[model samples]
Target: MTGPTLLADLVDTSQRVGEHAGRRTKIARLADFLRRLSPEEIDIGVSYLAGVTRQGRSGIGYALIRDAQPAANVEVSELTLAEVDATLDQIAGASGRGSIADRTRLLSALFARATTREQEFLARLLLGELRQGALEGLMIEAVAAAADLPAANVRRAAMIAGGIASVASLALAEGAAGLSRFAIALFQPLAPMLAQPADDITDAMARIPMAALEWKLDGARVQVHKSGDDVRVYTRTGNDVTAAAPEIVSAVLRAQAQSLILDGEAIALKPNGAPYAFQDTMRRFGRMLDIEVMRATMPLSVFFFDCLHRDESDLVSTPAATRFEAMTAALPSELLIPRLVTSETSAAQAFYDDALGRGHEGVMVKALDAPYEPGARSATWLKVKRIHTLDLVVLAAEW
Candidate 1:
């Protein structure tokens, strides 16, 4: 029905299904109800499905659905079950090969079959998120209940349901009994991220198992959070900082992956677009309010060395090498870390010399297999730089 009503149904269904978790007979009954819906009806069903599924009683199975915007001609704000089901079928048929005409026809068919509530449900399903139950299994039950069937059967049936449209059709065909044999699964764990604290970078170093050190960059720390077509940038303080770095944000938005969060430093670049010194980038830091002045004075060039999340997977607990591989694969060539692998102290020293020759702060020597730990500062990293410091009797003290 409508987004709200369908959401309510999903919750009720999931609760019903939940009531008989291990009962295979009940689950089978739910499955049958899911089988009865048409492709268009399935489209309507998934909006509520997605909402309830997201709400903890279920998982993240709805990720397979490609979220779309509302129709240009429609004035309504939400979607219905049949509309959601039809949309899913259209998307499934379009997978890998479907022309614009095919998509248009699919939409037309959905619009024709979907009731007002179904239309609303379909709209939300296309968007891929429903604020309602939002749990996976629970939503499936809600769909079952909407069709006058047992919620218990649908819970297990979700596993073999394939996609929303598939589940809807099955529910319609055999009622509750049809839904008991699907393969729906729960959401994956949160993607791992390299931990860092707002209070101190050095503290983060202490948590690492191997050699870790401070990276003194006169630049800003950036956390790029991306989900589907949307990408947003945040500073170390978790403030939204995308407007100031549109170029970088656009670059990240164009990436081929599905979802991710990355960590790196963004420094200002020269007119020719070459990276400038760290000090030059410092001029633009913390100037979010005066974006125009900052943009004109110093633009940024981002360098990515670590990845926190990649395509629905967290990499925090993963070893550095593993995370590094993913980082290299996804990172653009122009913005990259100058990496060096060395097991020997002498080799590390040599690398340090080269880094200094290139005007870098120093070379960071890290243990080959260490997990990133945030908020601890210690020597899992060794930073070597060439500079002389001495107190030459106040040579000239001028304020």
Candidate 2:
């Protein structure tokens, strides 16, 4: 489409994008560049501008990339976009006994052919840290501009698609129609909805009138997705921990729902029925082999707060209260977290006090009518917690 676009062009563009302080200028430059790239190259361009590699910091580390260097007078325009992509794929896929040596040889050859600028960019790409000021937000706007669609549509597609690469390619090629096809598939972890910080219940209540207050447990956040007998658990960062959380997996299998996605927290409890310390729960989380032994000693209990999907429906678009209702209807009472819907100041304070007294960190006050907004955080959901600032110096450690 544009003179068989070279990797140098991309490296040069990244440098230009990073130089500008104004966001509008960065968006304009990126959109212009995206328009020139072929359809196959759009995803790569998006990944570069968004400050990452498609390989995602695969096996290769910064030390490995730093040792590999190029000559002073190197070829600038020899490598094409597809050529660089293939080289990265090979480096990422290198495995087995002599794999590290093989990877080093591959990097040496690739860098030797690249110019100084290309080498610099490639090293950063492999290390997965493009210092370019342009990131996903800027890339989304650029993709929207290149595709001639509203930025909102592209952003929504990004949330469902789980990243900007596929969304960019789809938006640039097929526009809005391609984006519409991106939906929440079973067991595919969508980005978890996040919350904003609030000082206290009164301040939080002032932001949202009919707030849903739930005890914020001091434990790991979990997203449990169940499709019939199939169940999986994902951590806050969307890593599958189902095998590590056998109790949670079993509860989801036993839950009343057939098709559902649940958002919850798993807390380890003492024999006296009080919850154990957060650190103790994390120990159990890290214990892979001694799970059954730990279950007898320090059993973990899950408390689900939000239902993202249930019974062949995406419940995220519904009101928070509606989703909570579905969650109550499906899960056992022991599995559901303690929650209350109240606008009164006194009730909110009592809930807050009760949670802290019961070994929890604090309570989360959420808007009853608010839809689940993933990735972005706002005042719609407020977490009120007691703050204890610490300034410490590590003196010594036993090895």
Candidate 3:
């Protein structure tokens, strides 16, 4: 009903857990509420939801509208405290879009009639940290509670609404429970695993755990799924990217294996078959490029290490050696994953030494008996980087 309450509701509806239809219904409701509020009250609401600039500017209303338009090309960046204060001042004094008796009036009119991108920009300007925070969630809950609707129902309904504003509208009418009822889909078996910082070969080698080690190549982490002639390639984020790298996808399609998921590094290779820098491979990712130029500039070679799906069964729970065997059988190239046949730590160390001599990053020490955990960066498959450093602790205390 109020500006702050409306803003909060919009945020709640944007939560990924809700149903799309419900969220849309909520958005429509919020829009109706905005229509009832006076321009001045709306400005006050914007300022309250997102702190007003020192100059009294509340860009939240304008931002919200701008964000909804396809033609609205807006770039948001981090702002300093001083910048926030200045914008507030400028907004408070400026009058153009509508009759402005005050900052609140101006903001209300801006949001009420502005484009989607404008509204999005304004909301970000108001909320500060527009990417992630409690504002979106809290607003939804506040709105739902205000309307005396079961928050859970609203949240479920919100999934249909989609977008930040739609969810917010639901929250205004239904409350926090509405946002909570929706199921959030992560969609992938793997999350984005962070690479431990490895400056050089020695540093990577030292980090290697006491387990079976394979050379770590400089490449992009790729998950390849093959079911007969069909193939799927997923990046670390689980986004399907088979079309981006058709050659690699086709290679997986041609594999003799049926229904297998192989996790490995996809590297750009030189003409003589040497892998290029990691940056080179990154250039080809998610780009519309000429195939001939792409092949010439960034030829890729996927080095398989772990197998998840194998032979009509998910072999992720199987032992590392078993999975390795399956991976080896699925492809003919030794370059897939050059493994060593030695239980001895010294032998593994020797292999690591040899791999580095071939310009590899380092070795990944995997427990031979372990299962393939997609996203886990456990010590079971410890990554060893070759870097030299001492963990030196400060002897004295600092303020």
Assess each prediction's global lDDT (C-alpha) against the native: 0.52, 0.84, 0.55
Query: Every model's Cα RMSD, please?
Result: 17.1, 3.7, 13.5
lDDT of candidate 2? 0.84
Summarize candidate 1's per-residue lDDT along 338-385 as a digit string, tens digits.
Answer: 675534445445555565555556544455476554322324444444
* 1-399 per-residue lDDT for model 2 (tens digits): 556678888988899999999988988889999999998888888887788878777677866765555444375568878887788899889999988887887887788878877887888777767789888888888888889999888887787676778688878888888888777788788888888999888898888878889999889889988988889988987888887888998887878888999988998988766788889899887678878888888777899999989988898789998999998999889888898889898999999999888878999999988888666666688999978899999997532
Q: What's each prediction's clash count?
A: 111, 0, 82
The global Cα lDDT (0 to 1) of model 3 is 0.55
TM-score of each candidate?
A: 0.42, 0.85, 0.50
**Mind giving the per-residue lDDT tens digits that candidate 3 earns over 329-396?**
87867437777655555677688888777778777766678765433445465566676679898897
> Which 10 successive residues of model 2 have the least lDDT summed?
67-76
**Candidate 2: where are CA atoms >4 Å away?**
2-4, 19-25, 59-66, 69-75, 90-111, 122-131, 200-203, 286-290, 393-399
Ranking by TM-score: 2, 3, 1
- Overlapping backbone residue pairs in candidate 2 total 0
